[model samples]
Target chain A: MEQTAQSKSRYGMVIDLDRCTGCGVCMVACAVENNVAPAEQKATERTGVTWLRVYPVSNGEGFPANDTVFIPMTCQQCGNHTPCVSVCPQNAVEVDPSTGIVGQIPQRCLGCRYCMTACPYHARYFDWWDPQWPEGTEVLLNPDVAPRMRGVAEKCNFCHGRLHAARTKAAAAGRKEIAAGDYVPACVESCPSRAIVFGDLADETNEVSRLSHSINTFQFLPKLGTAPKIFYHSAKEWVRKMADRAPLA
Target chain B: MRCKGLILMLSGVLASLAIGWFAFPAALYRTEAQPMQFNHAVHTGEQNGMTCDMCHEFTENGSFKGIPTIAKCTECHSAAIGSTESEKVLVEQFVTPHKEIPWKVYSRQPDNAYFPHAAHVKRAEIKCEECHGPHGSSSTLPVYQVNRISGYSRDIWGRNISGLPSHPWEGMKMDRCVRCHAERHRDDSCLDCHK
Candidate 1:
C-alpha cells in the first residue's frame, strides 16, 4: 500500500534482433507517442530527437557473407551505476527506485549535455529547439506524455507516461498491484514482428525476465559493468559480436 | 567656491539615487491597473463572512479553480446587491454580459512549475493566508507589475532589490521553497516541484 513512486522493480526489455526488419516502425511510434517534434531543418542522426533509433548493422565480409541486423537502440536503463544520472549537475536524470526505469525531468535539466557526453551508448539526445508539432497533427500526439520543451537531454524512459496512467488506474481500481498488460512502451507495442518484450525483470516469473536469462540473449557493453537492463537476443554470431562491442568512452 | 563644488557633487549623488531606486525598477516592471477591482474585506469580513474557499474552491478532481467565473459572483449579485458603485460595475460590466473576470493572479507560477494545490492545501493542511499573506482581509488591490526580462510578477521576487523577503512567505523564488522543504524534510528533488 505504501509503494508511492519509489518501487524497486527492474522494469526492462528483451528485444529479438533477428525478428527486427529495420522498418523503423518503433522510431515512428515513439515519436508520435512522446510528441517528439519534427526538425525545422533536415535532421541527421546526431541532430534529431529520436528516442528510439534503428541502426542497420552489417558484417564486413562481401557477397554471401554480407548480412544485416537492425538493432533498435534506446537508453539501456543501466542499474549498477547510471552514467547519465550521476553526471547530471541537476538531478534531472534518475533511476526511479520503484520501477527501476531511468527517468528524465526536462524541467530541471539545464541543457548542459553532461549526461549525453557521459552516456557510452549515445542514447541521450539534446533538444536543440522547442518541439514544434506539424500543423493539426498535435491531436495525434499522445495526451499521456508531456511534450518536452527545448534545451534538455531526452531519451527513452520505457514510456513512463503509460506507467503513470497504469498506476493511476490501479489506484482508482483499489488494486495494490498493477497488471503487467496495463503497462507497455510505445516501441514494444508498435513492433509488427513482436521483436520487443517489456516487463518487470525483477519478477522472476515474468516472460521477459525469464527470456533475459536465455542462452541467445546478450546485453551491449556488459564489460563496462553498467549492468544495463535492456537485453538483446540473436541467433547470428556477428549480431552478438556487434552488440557486445567494447564500451566507447 | 567650495559651496558651489559641494552643491554640484550633492546634486549628482541625488540624481544617481533617484535613477537607481526609481528609474531602474520602473524600466524593469511595467505597471498596469486590473480590469476590475475586488474588495476581499467586504466578502471575508464579519458582515458577509465568506471564507476564501467559498469563491476559490477546488474542483472534485482537486485542480485549483484559480479565479472563479463571473457566474460565481452573479450567484449573489444577480441584480445589484447594494448601491455600491463597484457592485453596480460588477453586475453591469461582467454579470450581465456573462464575461469572465480576467484576474491576473499575483502568486501564479511559471509554466515549468508544478505546485499542486491539493498536496499543499488538502494533504499538508497549510492555510492559504500563510503563502498569500492577509490578502483576504485587505480592501485595496495591488498594482500588477510584470518584469520585462523574465515576465514574472514583482511579488514573485518580493518588493526588495536584495530579493530577501520581508515576511516568511514573501518570496516565491526556488530558494525560498527549497529552504522550507529542507526544514520540513520534504522531497526537494527538482522533479518533485518542477514536473
Candidate 2:
C-alpha cells in the first residue's frame, strides 16, 4: 500500500451534548483562543461571526414542556471528498494528512464566504468588520498566532495550534508521538460542563474513538456524507432527532 | 599628502554618517502612528506615577495579558488637572465620556500565539522597555495609527518583516517566538501560542 498523509492523522471530536448546559463557555473560549473578532452589540445574525456556534434546537413549545437543546457546531473535517474543500478557488483550506485537521488558511482566503454557504452546519464565519477589542485590550492578543486580518473566513480548527504545540513538546521530550493528554482544544478545556472531548479518531483505543462507539452517539448531518469528525451523544431521542435529517418516509 | 588626508577624513565622516543612517534603525526601531499623540513622559508626573502593570495585568492562568481599562485611567486622571493642552483634550474626549483612548498597540502577537507577560515580566524580570521602546523618554506624545484593514497600527505587525531584533526579541512574531524557545530548548508548542 502506498503511504499517504491520511495514514498519519485522523483528528476528530466526540461531544456529549446531553452533558452540555448551553452556557456558551465553549463558544466564548473558542472565540478568544482562536482570535475570532467581535461583533457590534447591534449586529444581527447576518453580520455576526461565530466559528463555534451554539444552535438552539427546540422541541416546539407546549405547556407541558418547552424544551430546547444546544449543539456546538464546528467544521466537520470530512474525509477525502469534502464539499467545501472542492469549491475553494484559492486552496485556502486543506485537510492536513498528519493531523487530520481541516486547516483554514486565512491569509489566502479571499473572503467570498463561499465555504460558509457550502457547509450545512454553518461552521464558517466571514469577518464583517475590522478586528476590534475593547480599548487597551489589544495587549491581550495571543502572541503565537497571526491574528486574522479583516476579510477572511474562520472556523473552529479543533485548536490545531494546540496539536502543533503538543507535537513540538513531544519532539523535545524525545518522544515519537504526542501523548493522549498532550493535546486538547481550548473549548474542551474550558467547558464548564465538560461536554466536549477531543482526540485522535484514528486511535481506536483513544477515548474519542471509544466514546464514539457508544450506542447513544451520532454525527451531525451524517447523511450529507461530510463524515464529520465530531460525534454527539445524548440519551434523549429528541436530541438525536435534531442532529440528523428527518428519516425517509 | 595633506590633500589626500583631507579627502580621507571627509570620506570617513561621510561613511560614518551613511552607516548611522542605515544602521540606526536596527539600533532603535520605532514605528509611526495614526492617532493623536499620547505619551507617558507628558502624562507621568508626581500625581500618579502608575506602572505599566497598572494598565496591563496577567490573567490568573498566566495565559493572557491585557491593556488597562478606562477605569484604571480614571483612577488618576478623572480629577487630574492636565499640565498641557493635549492632556486637557484627552480628559475631555476620553475621560469625561468614559471612553477609552484608542492608542494603537505597539506589540501584538499572532492570535494563535500565547505569551504570558506575567511569567516573562514578573517571574523572568524582563524590563517593559526592552520590547516597547523607551516610552519614558518621549516628551511629546504617542500617535496611534490604525491599520487600514485590521484597524491596528503597523507597529503591531512589526518594524519590518525581515528586520529581526538583535536580542532574544523582535516585534512579537512567530519566528522570534520559535527562535527564543529553540534557544532555551523549551517546548514551543503551537498550543502554547494557539489557544
Candidate 3:
C-alpha cells in the first residue's frame, strides 16, 4: 500500500439518512476536534462559522403523516470543477490530487468571500469575529489544530490534523501506508448511531466505496457536475429526489 | 553646470542605494543573544563525537524535538567536566536548579507553516546541514535576529535584503520549499505544509 499522502486515494464519506437521529453530536465533535471557536454575542446563524451543520429535512405533510431526515452537510470535497476552487482569487481553496480532499488555507485567504459565494452547497463560512472561548476553556482547545483568525473563509477539510498525525505515526514505524482504522474523522467517530462511513472511495474493498455505489446512495446537486465525493444513502424516494434539489432559503 | 548636475544625481542614487541595502535591514531586524553560549564543534569534535541527532532527536511519534531539554545536558554535564565559565554557569545556574535553558531558535517558523523534520530527515534522508546550513559544525552560536514586523527569524528570509540567498540553505520561505519539491518531482498540496 502506498502512503496516503503520495497515493491517489479519493477520500470520501457516506451518510445514511435513515440511521441519522439528528443528535448533532457530529457537529460538537467537529467543533472540538478542529478548534472551532464559539459564536460571539452578536453572531447569528448567517454570520457564525460551522464547518459541519445538520439540517432537518421534512416531507410536507400533516404532523401524523410527516417524515423527516437529518442531512449532515459539509464541504462535500468536490472532485471535478469545484466552484470554490475556481473562484478563489487567493488560491486558498484547492482539491488535493493525492487525496480528493478540498483544502482551504485560512492563512492564505484575504477575506474576499468569493469562494463562499461560488459554493453552491453554501458550505464555506467567513470568520466574522476573532476566535474566542470561555475564560477557562482555552486550554481545552485541540493542540493539533490552530484556530483561524477573523477575516478569512473556512470550511471542513475532513479533520486534516488527524490525517497528519496518522501519516507521522506511519512514517515513524517505517511504514508507507497508514492503517485504515488509524485515520477516522471526528464526525464519523462521534456519530452515535454510526450513520457516517468514511474511507478511501477509490479502494474497491473499502466500505465507503461500496456504500457510494449502493442502490439508494445519491449525491447532492448532481446536475451541477461538481461530482462531490460525499454520498448520501436513503431508502425513501422523496429524500433521494430532494437530494437533487437546491437548499431552500 | 552639467558636471554639477551629474554629481547631484549621482549623490541621490548613492544615498538611495545605501538606505535600501544597509539602513533598511538595520531597521527591519532586531538581534538578541542566546541564553548562553554553546559550542557545537566541541560536541561534534573528536573528543565528544556527538552527532546532531543525538541532541536534536525525533520523538517516538516522529515529531522532531527542536532543542533538547536540560535533562539531556545533565546526562553528561551532571558535573562540570570543563572549567570554562559557560560550563560552570550551566551546572551551577541551570543544572543545579533544574531550570531549563531558553535557547532562541533561528529557524523557528510561523505557527501557520508546518515543517516536519521527521519527513525531511528520517524519510528523505536530508542532512541537517541542508536546510540549516553548517551551524551544527560551528564553534559559536550566532546572534538570533528577528524581523520586527513579521516576528519571524531573519533566517526565514535569509541575510540578504534583496531576498536572494547567498547559500542554498539560507532561506526557509515558501519559494525555497517549492523549489526543492519541484526539483524532487514531489507535487504536494498546500494543506500538506499549511495548517
DockQ of each: 0.11, 0.06, 0.45
Candidate 3, superposed: residue stretches over 4 Å from native: A1-5, A136-138, A246-249, B1-10
Better of 1 and 3 by DockQ: 3
Fraction of native contacts, model 2:
0.09
- TM-score top scorer: 3
User: What's the C-alpha lDDT at position A226 in model 1?
Assistant: 93
Relative to the unseen true structure, what is the C-alpha lDDT of residue A14 in candidate 1, on a scale of 0 to 100? Answer: 97
lDDT of 1 by residue, A182-228 (tens): 88999999999999999999999999999999999999888889999
Ranking by TM-score: 3, 1, 2
Question: How many pairs of residues collide in model 1?
Answer: 4
The C-alpha local distance difference test score for the whole of candidate 2 amounts to 0.69
Provide the TM-score for each candidate, comma-separated: 0.75, 0.57, 0.94
Number of the predicted model whose DockQ against the real structure is largest: 3
Interface RMSD of each: 5.7, 11.8, 3.8
lDDT of 2 by residue, B1-195 (tens): 999999999999999987776775444444555345556654455555667775676544343346576787688778646576666766778888999777656675444344656545654466887667676447665544444555444455554534555443345555666675666555333434443
Residue-level lDDT of model 2, residues A1-249, one tens digit each, is 111112365888888888888999888888788766677676777678777888877877796797888888878778757777788898877776567677787767898888878887777877777878889877776544467777888777787766655655544343456777867888899999889888888888888889988898998777777788888899989777766656452
B10-84 in candidate 1: lDDT tens per residue?
Answer: 999999999998889889998867777789999999999999989987665445677789889989989988887
On lDDT, the candidate that comes out on top is 3
Q: Candidate order by lDDT, highest to lowest? A: 3, 1, 2
